[model samples]
Target: MEKFTRLTSVAAPLAEADVDTDIIFPARFLLLLDKAGLGKHLFHERRHRRDGGMTDFVLNTPPFNEARILVADANFGSGSSREQAVWALADFGIRCVIAPSFGEIFFSNCFKNGVLPIVITGEAHANVMAAARTGQPFTVDLEAQTVLLPNGPALSFDIDPWRKRALLLGLDEIGGILADDAEDISAFEARHRVDNPWLFLDDGRMEQLLSQGDGK
Candidate 1:
């Protein structure tokens, strides 16, 4: 996972609410084994017509095509618990998603993949959406927990402290758990070795087994 600190980039606005995971990455691309190369498939169903021709979607346009921040309406990422949704966004170079609300599962997936899902409501949400429409650049400061608009006052947002720390340190859930309890893990391993000697292979025993195999 990459460390997410302060990101300043062009933001694309998708004002529709209830934008689901299927719309973001589609079900067809879900068969992919790896997260890489999914960027081109981001918003596939919406960005392309039935005939496979490109549509006039915001992401398919200039300026917005290079957007790294996405400003969306309420209930963003609402549908199935597909982790690929976050993978598609991250692969597309989108580091942050600003919405009034997000689906619980999708919201959690964002942090796991280094995508910052920000909940900004009321004036701040309106302001950021407005800025995105003009293709203006905005900044998201994970350290400060604020979204800096191009012309308006910075909007503050809240995130779990542990999630923030994990993003800052580029630690995924597994990485965070291991890192947080490294000493305990080491101590447990030491105790386990003493308690269950049969669980480990003794060097002398291994050498004896190898000698027996050679003799056979």
Candidate 2:
């Protein structure tokens, strides 16, 4: 995973609520085993027309096409659990998603996949949505936990400290565990091996077991 310390780039506004995982990345494309080129499949249904042409969707238009931040309404990523939704966003170069709320699963998946899903409300969220409409640059400072809008005002958002640390250090969940608890994990494995010696048998032990098949 890549570090998401900060981003200053175009933001696209998608004011719709309950956008859902399917809308973000169609299920049919879920068959894709590779993460590469998933960007072209992001919002596949919305970006394509019935005849397989490009629609006038916000993401297909100028400036928005290169968006690094996505400003959306409440419940931005709802529906079934699909980590691919976050994958699509990341592949599309969107580092952050600003929404009033997000699906519980999607929210967690974002952090694991190097995408920041921020929750904001009240006037601040309204201001963000308004700023996104302009297709101008907005700066998101992960270390500062603030978003500097196009004009001037900066808004702060909250994130779990551990998740924030992982994002800053470019560590996924397993990577975080190894980085933080490698010693503890090693100690546990050592104890387990001593307690269950048969589970870690050497070549000599394996040969003995194989030869003992005569006693079966």
Candidate 3:
């Protein structure tokens, strides 16, 4: 997962609420096991028509096609707990999603994959969506916890200090372990192996311990 310290790019405005995983990445696309080329399928139904035409979806707009930040309404990613929703967004180069609310499962999945799902006030969300209509670039500063608008004042948001630090430093779960207590971890493993000799099976003992630490 890439770090998301600070981002300044075109922001795609998806004002619709209750955007389920199916709408973000349809079930048909999930049949393919690869995460590649899914960006073209991100919002497949909304971007294409039944007659195999285009419907001018939010993501298909001019500069919005390259948007890194997404401004959306409440209950974003509400339906299923499919990890593909996060995959599609990240594959499409969307680093952050700003909304009034988000599905619990989807929110956790975002952090695990290094995506920042920012929760802002309803009024601020509306303001950002309205500004996105200009199709101009916006900035999301994770360190500052501010969303820079085009024609309006900067919008402030709250992210858990830990998650904010994680996103800013691009530290997913594994990264956190290495950063938070590398020495302590090494020392513990040494002590544990000395105290519990039976735990080590063979040459893969260290690898097994590292994997077990990651599972936490």
Give the alpha-carbon lDDT of every model.
0.93, 0.92, 0.86
RMSD of 1: 2.0
Per-residue lDDT, model 2, residue 133, is 93
lDDT of 3 by residue, 22-71 (tens): 89888887787787777778899888889998889878877888888898
**Model 3 lDDT at residue 17:** 89
Mind sharing the TM-score for model 2? 0.91
- Please write out the lDDT profile of model 2 over residues 1-216, one tens digit for every residue: 999898998899999999999999999989997888898999998999889899999989998988999999999889989889989899999999999999999999999999999999988999999899988888999999999997867899999999999999999999999999999999999999999998999999899998898785
Clashes of 3: 0
Q: Spell out the clash pairs found in candidate 2.
A: none
Kindly report which residue stretches of model 1 are placed more than 4 angstroms away from their true locations once superposed.
209-216
Model 2 has an lDDT value of 0.92
By lDDT, rank the candidates, best first. Answer: 1, 2, 3
lDDT of 1 at 190: 100
Which pairs clash (backbone N, Cα, C closer than 3 Å) in model 1?
Answer: none
Q: Give the C-alpha lDDT of model 1.
A: 0.93
